[model samples]
Every structure is written in structure tokens, then in C-alpha cells.
Target: MKWVTYDAGSGPRTGILDGPTVRGLGAGVTLLSLLGDDGERLAEAGAAARTAPTEVRPLDEVRLLAPIPRPPSIRDGLCFLDHLRGCYRAMGRGGELHPAWSQTPAFYFGNPAAVVGPYDDVPIAPGCELFDFELEIGAVIGRGGRDLHPDTAEEHIVGYTFYNDWTARDHQLRDMAQGIGMGKAKDSAITLGPALVTADELEPYRSDGRLHLEVSATVNGREVSRGTLAAMDWTFGELLAYLSRGTDLLPGDVIGSGTVPGGCLLEHVDTPDMAGFSGWLRPGDVVSLQGPALGHTRQTVRPAPPMIPLRTGC
Candidate 1:
């Protein structure tokens, strides 16, 4: 079942996406609450809602929001070796990936408060010159767990959604020199949604223990990058196990698959492939991502507000 959170003038409500229509599951129910809903009650309720005509609306008429607007937490992992390889190439660092990358998936927490709706305008990071978007998949946790095993981690995932891990390349690079955190480089925006598709809905695209869906991205109506989720060297299950080693993963938590290979402009910036185009995202630039089952979304890049001056600069 594909789920959505939308507002139809009144307020935000949980809904089931059925083709051209969005069937609102009524008041008091939120996508966050549904993540922890046990038994067959949700299914039965969704079934019942489909037959009723009370809150159903055309998909184009309602305002869509991220399935779990403000996730409890966001864990983004470097699961795709291609993205790593691309980064290495862009940075002129000639070496194979770290041995630990093959043994365990490493991840960083993102700001949940930075999340925005699919169609929301994404502002360029303040004080950043190289704004970019990362195309990837995000798995939403349905059940909370600790020290989970990789083999059984899939059971805890409720659904998957298209994730845009927006970044500020210059800020990230500068912060790397400090050997510190990402700072505000990735704190600006993270777009999610259109619809959260459950596992069963994406069954047709699953292969080799990973999703083989056709993923493509474009900026300003020009094709920037394209690839499949199967390009990932690590699996979400493995990522879950490593990330949950000592920490608890709660319902409403989102696990990002990092950026897919060739999924972001930073990877193509200095490359011959994107040579003619400016790699950084600019104001009024429209960025889009698409995949089968998982819905598509387009967001226009808006200008960043004036940069806040640092009084105590180093």
C-alpha cells in the first residue's frame, strides 16, 4: 500500500494513494502514528476508507507533505560505492575505498527538522556557493528495535520513499578540512515524499536482495544523472544492523541509502560528462527524481537568504 500525508484546505491527514486519488484515512490519524500501528487494523481501515466517498480527493488537488514530515531521526549511509568512487575522482584522491566500507556501512545523522515536502521550494544553503541534490531511497522504520540482525532488519521497514539529501558542497569540503561534522552543509533541506510505497508495492523491482528500480535525476529540465538502486554495494539490512549496533531505531526513523551512483552533480562537477553545465544548483533551477513504484517529485531551487555573519571567526 502506498501512503501519503496531504492537506486538502482543512489540515494535514494520512491518506492512501490509489492511482489518481488520495483517500484520506480521516482525522486524528497521521503517517507517523500509522508506522507503529499493529495487527491488521490499519489494512482493514484502509480498505474501508477506499469504499467510502467522504474524504477522497484527486491527487492533483491536494497539497502533499512528507509521509513522516519530521522524522524522529534520519540516518544516511554511504551504501553506494559508485558515489564513493565519484567523490574520490572529484577530489583527486586516488585510492580504493576504505577496508571498513566493505565490512560495515557507516552513516551520519541528519537534521530531521530540515525535512520538507516533495514539491516545496528548496532554498540554496545560506553562505554556500555549491548547492546540490542527492538522489536516493529512504526506508522508514515501522517498529523500534535495538541490536537488530541484518537478516531480519527488513521486517522493521514499513515503506520506502524518494529522498533528496540536499547538500552544500563548498561547506562540506571546508568542514572536511577541520575533520569535524558536516555542520550546516547538510542542514538546509531534505525533500521526501510524493508517496511512501510499501515493500509489497515494489516487489516487482526487487532483485539480488536489492531494489533494481530505474532511478534518474534532472536539473533545470536537463538530464544530470541516471542509474539504478542496484548500484549500491551495501544493502539496507546491513546498514540497519551496523547503525543499530548499540543504538535503538524507533518507528518514524528514516534510513537513507545515501546518494546513488551518479546521483548528484558533485560527482559530475569536474567530469567531462557534465563539463558544459555548471554543477551547482542555482535559484529557479528545477530538480527532479523518479523511480518505479516510488513516486516522482520536482522542486525549484530558491535563493538563499543573506548569510549570517560569524562574529567569532577563527
Candidate 2:
């Protein structure tokens, strides 16, 4: 079942998206609430909620929010080969690409509270010339446990969703230059959702030919980045296993599988060799991503305040 978090005339509520309608999930509003419980309980609750008479609303009419407005924890991994290669090449160290990254999933914390939904306005900070978009797949955790084995990692994932890890490259590079961690107040980079597709529902798509999902990003109507899910070096299971090693995996925790090759303008634009690449995403740009049965979302970029100087002497 496709679950969504949306605002009806009454307020925010969790619902099952059916065709063009959404059936409310009682007072248990927000998808995070359902995710807070284990998958079994979620399944039971969802079954019951379906049969109850609900104020079904037009899916397009209701205001859509991120499936989980505030994920309990957000851990993103840089485990994609395309992204790795692109980053290394940008640093003039293309030969330094590590094929053994599957053994060590590099990750960073993201702001869970900053997530916006499908058609939401992605505010672009002013005085920034390096707006970018990253097409990624995010795994939603359904249970809490530690030291999970890669073999059993699938058990911990309840579903998956599409994410656009939007970024401001100028500010990001500034932080990178100082040798500071990547999470330097980049609280606004994360965006995702149309709805969450359960693991069982998308399992068939995980296999070879069927796993072919196209990801494309557009600035205005022109395409900037395009790639396939098949390009990922490490499977989602490997990332789960690697992450659960030293930490407890809790319900509602989101793990973004980094970005695919050619997933953003930074991959091509930053290089003088690719000088002809057009301008990066800017205000009024509309970025969209679409997959086979997973649906798509178009978000308009809005102008935002300039990036504040990094605070020190705290």
C-alpha cells in the first residue's frame, strides 16, 4: 500500500493512497507515527484503517508533506560508485576511487526536520550560484536493532522513497576547504516523497533488468542530470549492514544511498574540462524525478536568504 502524510482541511493525517483518493488513518496522523511502531504493528494498523469509513480526499487536492516529516534519525551514506568517481575526478584524484567502499559505507548526518514533499517550494539561499540536485533512493527503517548482518538487512527496511539531496555547492565547497564535516548547517539540502513503497512491493524491481529505474533532474525545462538505479555499486542491504555495525538502527530512521553518477550538475559543471555545461539550478528552477511505478514530483525553487557565516567562539 502507498502511504502518505498529507494535510486535509482538518489537519495533517496519515493515509493510504488509492487511485486518485486518500483514505485517512484516524488520529494517528503523519507517517512517522506508523513507522514509530514495528512493521508488524504497522501492517495490522494499516489493514484496520483501510476498512474504516474515512474522509477520502483527492490526492492532488490535499497538501502533501514528507512521508515522515521529522525522521527519528537521518543517516546518509556515500556508497554510490558514480558519486565516488565524480568526486574523485573533481579533486583531480580519479585514480583514488575505492572499489572496496562496499566494505565501509561512508555516511553523514542530515537534517530530518528539513525534508519537504513532492511539490513543495525548495527555497534557494540568496547569493548562491551553485544550486544542485542529487537523485537518490532512501531506505526507511521499520525496526530497532544493533549490529544487523547484511544477510538480514532487508528485514530492517520497511520501504523506500525517492529523495533529492538538493545542495548549494559554493557554501559546501567553503566548508570542505576548511576541513570541517559536511554537515555545516546544510539543514535545507534534503527533500523527498510522493509516497513510500513497501519493501515487499518493490522487491521484484530489485532484480537485474527490472531494477532499471531512470533518474533525471531538470533546471527549468532543460535536463541537467540523468542516470539509472542500476549504476549503484553497493546494494541497499550492504549499506544497512554497514551502518548498523556500531549504532542502533531505530524505526523511522532514513538512510539515503547518496547520489548516482551524473546525478547532479556538480559532477560535470565544476570541471574546467566540462566548461560548456550550463548554469546550475537557480531560483525559479523546477527539478523533477520519475521512476517506473514509483511516481514523480516537480518542485519549484524559491529564493532564500544568503548563507549565514559559520558561527565560532561558541
Candidate 3:
């Protein structure tokens, strides 16, 4: 079943998306709350909710919000070798893949407070001239667990959603030069939405031994990047297991699949066809990311505010 969180004049509420209309499950109910409950029971309740006579709202009449507006935690993983190689080469680092990448999955913690909805405006980072987007898929954790094995990690996932990992290239490079990690560069803004597709709904696509989902991004209605989830070097189960090592993962926690090959502008700016394109996102530019089972997330770029300087005290 497809689940959505939207506001219909009252407040954020949970609903099941049926065609172009959204059937309300309950007032004040949220995706996070549903995820915290038994997965089987939640599915049963959702199935019943879809058939019962309830308040139904047209999709256009409501404002869609992030499935879990404030997720418990956000972890983004770098699981695409093609994207990594391109980025390293573009940044003047060698194109050779890191040896550790083949043996282990790597990820970074993103700020949950910066999460935004599908149609929200993304403000350009102040003093940042090179803003970019990373097209990704996010797995939402259902059951909390620690020291989870790879074989059992899939049981902890409830559903998946589209993720747009916004980036300020300038700030990110500066942070890398100073060895300060992602810091403010990545924590500024991230979008996740449209709807969350449950694991059961996506089981058919898993027959190929990999998640066979197509991912693509468009800027101002012009398609730019494309890749497949099958390109991921690491699977979601592996990343989840790695994250659970000596750590506890709770319900409502989100883990991202990272950027697919050619998913970001930084990787394509030097290509022959894209050589004339400007690498930075401009105000009023709308970026839409779409996938097969997972729905689409569209974000409009808003003008940047005046840069706030860091105060240096004596």
C-alpha cells in the first residue's frame, strides 16, 4: 500500500493514496506512528482503510508533506561506484575507486531537522554559487534492532521513498579541504516525499537479484540525468546491517541509497553535451526526481538570502 502525509486545511495527517484521491486513515495519524506499530497490523489497517467509507480528498486539494516530516535519524550511504568515480575525477582526485569501498559500505549522518516536503521551496545556500542535487532512494526503518545480520536486515525496513540530497559544492569542497566532514554543507536542505511504497508492494521488482528501479532527474522540465538502482554497488540490506553494528536503529529512521551514476550536475558538467551548461542551480528552477515504485519529488529553487557571516570574537 502507498502511504502519504498531507495537510488538508486542518493539520498533517496520514492517508493512503488511491489513484488521484487520498483516503484519510485517521485525524492526526502520521507515517512515523504507523511505522512504530506492527508492520503486519499496519498493512491490515491500511487495507481496511482503503475500502471503508472515509473522508476522501482530491490529490490537488491537499499539500503533500514528507512521509515522516521529522524522522528519528537520517543516514545517507555512498553505494554507487560510478558516481564516486566521476566525482573524484571531477574534483581532481584520481578516478581509481577506493580499496575500502569494495570491502565496506560508507555513509554519513544527515540533519533530520532540515527535512522538507515534495513541493517545498529550496533556498539557495547563501554564499554558495554551485548548488547541486543528488537523486536517491531512501529506506525507512520499521522495527528497532541492534547487531542485525545482513540476512535479517530486510525485516527491519518498512518502506521506501525518494530522496533529494541537496548539496553546496563550494561549502562541501571547503569542508573537505579542512577535514571538517559534511558539516553545514550537507545539512542545509534535503527533500523526501510524494509517497512511501511498502516493501511488499516492491517485492516483484526484486526478482533480478537487485532492485530493478529506474531513477532519473529533471531540471525545469528538461531531463538531465538517468541511472538504475541496479547500479548500486552495495545493497540496502548490507548498509542496514553495517549501520546496526554496535548501534541501535529505531523506527522512523531513514537510510538513503546515495546518488546513482550521472545523478548530479557535478558529474556531467565536463561531458561534451553538457559542457555549456552552468553547474549551479538558479532561482525558480524546478527539479523533479522520479522512480518506478517510489513516487516523484519536485522542489522549486528559491532565491538565496543575504549571507550571514560567522562572528569572530576576541
Measured by C-alpha RMSD in angstroms, how accurate is candidate 2?
3.1
Question: Count of backbone clashes for each model?
Answer: 0, 0, 0
Model 3 agreement with the true structure over 1-314: per-residue lDDT tens digits: 88888899989888889999998877766778776655976786697678872579999999999989999999999989889999988878869986899998989999999999999999988878899999999999988888888876978999888999999998898888888568768978889888888888888888656778887999887778888878889888888999999999999999999898888888877778575565579998899998778878888999878886777520
* TM-scores for every candidate against the unseen true structure: 0.95, 0.89, 0.95
Lowest-scoring 10 consecutive residues by lDDT in candidate 2?
305-314
- Model 3 weakest lDDT span, ten residues long: 270-279
- Cα lDDT of model 1 overall? 0.85
TM-score of 1: 0.95
Task: Tell me the tens digit of each residue's lDDT in model 2 across 192-311.
Answer: 788887877776666653345666766666666677666667666777888888889888899998897767777776666445545677677788877765677789888877655557
lDDT of 2: 0.75
Q: Looking at model 3, how many pairs of residues clash?
A: 0
Question: After superposition, which runs of candidate 2 have C-alpha atoms over 4 Å from their true positions?
Answer: 36-38, 91-95, 98-102, 208-212, 270-278, 306-314
